[model samples]
Target: MDELEFMRGRVYGADHDDAAPRPGRVYAELVGGPLDGLLLDVTDRTERELRGGVVLPTEIGRHGPGGGAVYAPRGPGDRRFDWRGDVP
Candidate 1:
């Protein structure tokens, strides 16, 4: 399956553990890049000891100028994705 489906079916699935990343309603802010202003599905997050980062798995979103929708993976330390609110 695709990244989005895999993430949805596995990572955020009901069968997943409580520590697993829960899906959030709001889109995360993509910091300092062409991806700025573009929204992505807030999949999961890493803990503060893990450097406190947000996870953006494969999801349908605008890529950039002249670029159409695409499935992208923005993990911790990417410097491209950022979340300012409370983390779960």
Candidate 2:
């Protein structure tokens, strides 16, 4: 599996016995832009929150510190979030 798929439901630095998604956790694969291929844990997010999208901090984005990358759900059932752009 690709990096994105492998990281599903898995947090960075966490240990697991298998590739299966962890129980009670949800993840969204980021696509495009600086944060591409990263996974965002969204287990605690409400449907309304998911629909509204999120901004994640990134050190490598165009604006550097104090900047964030925006990502939004691709659709109703999709697990991938598309990069909208960056914000300072």
lDDT of each: 0.36, 0.75
Off by over 4 Å in 1: 1-26, 48-88
Question: Model 2 — which ten-residue stretch has the worst lDDT?
Answer: 11-20
lDDT of 1 by residue, 31-78 (tens): 432233344435344434234543333223233333332223356544
Residue 48's lDDT in candidate 1: 41
TM per candidate: 0.25, 0.73
Model 1 scores worst on lDDT over the 10 consecutive residues at 64-73
Off by over 4 Å in 2: 1-23
lDDT of 2 by residue, 1-88 (tens): 9755654555422445643557778878888887776667778887788997888887677899889888899987577999999999
> What count of clashes does model 2 give?
0
Candidate 1 yields a Cα-based lDDT of 0.36
Q: What is the lDDT of residue 69 in candidate 1?
A: 27
| Local error of candidate 1 at residue 64 (angstroms) | 11
